[model samples]
Target: MTGRLWGLGVGPGDPELVTLKAYRILRDADVVAWFAATGRESNARRAVAVHLRPGQEELPLIYPVTTETLPAEVSYEGLLAKFYDEAAASIGALLDDGRDVAVLCEGDPLFYGSYMYLHNRLAAYYDHEVVPGVPSMLAGAAVLGTPLVSLNEMLTVLSGVLPADELYRRLVSADAVVIMKLGRNLAKVRDCVERAGLLARAWYVERATMEAQRVLPLADADAARAPYFSLVVIPSATAPGR
Candidate 1:
């Protein structure tokens, strides 16, 4: 019999935020797999490092290129597609050997997490389970001590990489917003927020729930220090109390 595949959401930076169900599966899985940048440690692995049982095999899926500024001759999308395909094959090998493989995701696996790509390729042929964990946006809101949406208010989650005009339109339409993937797009996103007249209401959070966490008004956030893990959250304009 082929071993089962598990996608474990390790939670946003904090090990304790991992759910009991996810923890149990993680400890029992025969092999642990994680995605990482070319030369960086895996954040998901770091979050759960202390809890991992000794002797479990580890598999690293390192990205060949993480930035979009690749050579004009190279196709970024094509390279990534091939990378994911190769990653799926490696994980499939472990599964076929009757060894249960657990892939660690930094946040909820389906929510902008790297595990989704592997899941899409392997699930059709294997028995798989996805264990959801705390997502970063909720962690950011918790750290800010601000309510996201009040009664009848719609909350929109956007990527900071969006075009300026598109970002502005969304910011203006949403009653509350969470813009993620800040990295190099911080300046553009900040500008869009200001143009939408929501700068004062927005708060920037970096690495929420982690040791290096920072929270400040979006307007005051330094663009140079904003990493991909950073985000800007705009709470509801109207107050709704218990």
Candidate 2:
């Protein structure tokens, strides 16, 4: 018998950011799974403490961050494929054994999310469910006091991991843009922001929804910008003297 699977996005870094539906799913989950850096912390797992139960099974998928330090030439696709294969194997084992599972996602499951990789791997073979949660962009936009997009505005969400030339083109045409994966890629992304002439309107948000959440104008931010748990949003309108 195929067991049930839940890919539940828990939002950015705050427990309060989790949706009521996500809360229900978490409380009822028979098994909890989250991505964890090989030997490091799991913020995703920590955020759900209010609803997490003792003795629930925990499946910690090895997140690539803070793990692989190889040269930049490595084919990330190949590396990620290996990780996905391994993750699928683990989830498959549990499902085959008739254990229902909840895969905790940090943000919207399908939005530049890690859960998608696992979901694509596991969902085809089992009964799966995706529980949407508050997105970081929403939480960050509220914290920064900015509406990400207005009527008919073309909004684009990009991965900072893209090549600058490619990213630049996309930014130029977009009325509002959200750049994710801004850790080590911050410099590259900042350059694109400058090239696109959108720095004046860009804002950076990090660890959104948490008490330690941070927001800053891209103009004042430095190379010391926080990486990983961060994002930059650029609105099309000029604030003042453009």
Candidate 3:
């Protein structure tokens, strides 16, 4: 019989934020897998490192590229597709051997987590389960002491990868907004927020719920020094102090 595959959301940056189910699953899992940039430690794994027991096989799926511009002949999407295919095959082989694999995710599994790649590839052929965890946006809001939304207010979550004009359009119309993936795209995001006349109201948060957390106005953020773990929040008119 094939062993089950589990996608465990370890929560954003904070080990304490992990759920009871996730802790148990990590401790008992035969194999623990996490994504990381090449030559860097895995944040997902680090979140639950304390729960990982001795003899548990740790798999670091090192990404080939992160934040760097792709060469003309190599497309970023193509590279990611190939990487996911290989990762899925490796995990599938372990499952076929009756070894349960738990893939650790930084936030909620289906909420833009890298675990979705494996899920999409293996779910059709194997039994799988997803355990949810607290996402960074919620944690960031808590740390910033700001409300994400008010009564009847719409909250829009956007990726900094969006086109400048498109981001500007959405920012102007949205009641509240959270911009994520703000590493190299911080300048672009800042421009869009400025164009929408929301720069002063924007708050920037880095590594929320973690030891190295930072919360400040977007105007004070340095685009050149921003890290990938940062987020920008724009409160709605109905929000307190707004």
Candidate 4:
């Protein structure tokens, strides 16, 4: 019989946020797979480090390129396709051996998490299940003591990597906004938020729920650069009584 494949969301940088189901799976899984930048530790694995059992086989799927700009001839999509294909093949081999594999995701597996790539490749052929966890935007809002939305208000989640005009349009149209993937695009996102006339209402959060967590006004964030784990939250204007 083919072994089961588990996609476990460890949650937004906090061990406490891991669900009891995720904890149980991690403890029982024969192999723990996670993604990481080449030459770096896996942040997903780190988030659930406390619960990992001794002697569990660790599989680190090192990415070839993370934030680096691609060359003219090399496309980001092609690079990622090749990487995921190989990663899936490796994981597939383990599954064929009847070894239960649990892939750890930093946040909710379906919510912009890297596990989607693997799922796209392996889901059709494998028996798999995804365990949900708190996404970073929700965690950030919690840390800021703010509500993401109020009744009848729409919340839009946008990637900072979106083009300036698109970002500006969405920012202006949404009742509340969560801008994610704020790394090298911090200045661009900041400009869009400002152009949307929501700068003062925006808050920046980095590494939410982690020891190095920080929440500050978007205007005060160092636009020079931001880590990949950063995001900006804009509360709804029509929030209750406001």
Candidate 5:
């Protein structure tokens, strides 16, 4: 009697940024799921709080990104694999009872979202839907007043953890670059942009629409110290020869 599960993108940090369609989906969903690592706050769930009514069930999936401290026995990926399997089993339990679940996603569901993991696990046995929301890169671009791309300009979105060689090559070829998860990788990323002669055009923004947002020209920020939510954008060079 229940309908399919929906993975809804709640947009960036600001609750106001949530899309109307995503809202309609969450407003009616019987169960809502979100992810949060140990000792951290659940911003994704907070982004959709207004839509949830009293007594509605909310589930939190504890997903911790493995760092080197973890032993090789269970391995980081192995542990995560277990978590995903368990999460799928739990969701499936609810689905078996005909309860439609809506999982909350920050930014777009497919763009570096955790919802994909849940979707992939349950898609085979359950009906599903994904509602796209505004991406942080686009929101960061707007906050900084930078045009993301124009005619014939390539746009590359890089995570903070990409290998140095791959990051350098892409920086050189792309007309515009938006590097997400700038956090601890800011120094390395900034250095690459500088070496590639794109430093003058680099800009960074953190938390996009949230009150604590930070926006800086790469030249002004002490790249080595930017926050985790920050990202950098490199616009096309104006002088072809310079």
Candidate 6:
């Protein structure tokens, strides 16, 4: 019989946050795969490293480029497309050989996880399962001790890379919001939040649940120090049970 493909979410930073199901599948898989930057260690692998037993083959899918900034001749989308295609092929080869392959994702596998690209490329031809894990946005709220959404409130999730005017418009209309992907875009995102009059209500969280975790008011955050894992969260104005 052909081997099954597993997309396992290792949760946000903390190893304790990994779901029992994900751990079990990860431990039993014949091969473990994870995406990482060219030289950096894989956060997803770190989350479940202890659980991996002897004899499991490890597959490291190194990214060709880690940042959006690239040479004029290179296309980010095209490069990534080719990369994922090659990665899918590698995993497919293992499956064809009856080796169950589990792909480790940092957060929920389907929520902006690299595993989604692999799933899209190979799920049609293979038996697979996706195990959801704790997403970073929720982890951010937990660290901030803030309620994310209240009754009848809508929570909007936005990418920090959006244009200034677009970010402002969305922030203005949002009841509760989480803006992710804040690295070099921190200044722009903060500016948009301030323009939308949500800066006072917004909280900035970095590396939530990790040893380097930090939480502060968005208005007071230093844009120059923001990392890719940082995010801005605006909790609901209405308190729960009020």
Cα lDDT of model 3 by residue, 138-229, tens digit: 88788878687988889999999899999998999999899999888898899899999998789999999888998999998965857878
Q: Candidate 2: lDDT of 194?
A: 92
Clash tally, candidates in order: 0, 2, 0, 0, 0, 0
lDDT of 2 by residue, 1-242 (tens): 86789999898878888889998888887789898777866777877866788787788887574535778888677788898889888888888888888899887888777889888888788999998877887777777775667777777989888999999999988888888888777888888999988898898888888777778887666875465778988865732222
lDDT of 2 at 37: 77
lDDT for each candidate structure: 0.90, 0.81, 0.90, 0.91, 0.81, 0.90
Window of ten residues with lowest summed lDDT in model 5? 233-242
Can you write out model 5's per-residue Cα lDDT over 1-242, one digit (the tens) per residue?
A: 54478889999878889988988888888888888877676778877776688888888888767333675665787788889999988888888889888888889999989889888998877889999998888888888765667777778888867877778888887788889876667788888888778888888788888779988788777856667568887766542321
lDDT of 4 by residue, 19-131 (tens): 99999999999899999998887889989998898877899899989878888999888898999999999999999999899999998999998899999999999999999
Candidate 2 achieves a global lDDT of 0.81
TM-score of candidate 3 against the unseen true structure: 0.96
The segments of candidate 3 whose C-alpha lies over 4 angstroms from its true place after superposition are none
Q: Which pairs in model 4 have colliding backbones?
A: none
TM-score of 2: 0.90
Error of 5 at 97 (Å): 0.9
RMSD (CA, Å), candidate 1 to true, equals 1.7
The residue ranges of model 6 lying beyond 4 angstroms of the native Cα positions read 240-242
Residue 156, candidate 5: Cα error in Å is 1.2
Error of 1 at 9 (Å): 0.7
| Candidate 1 pairs with clashing backbones | none
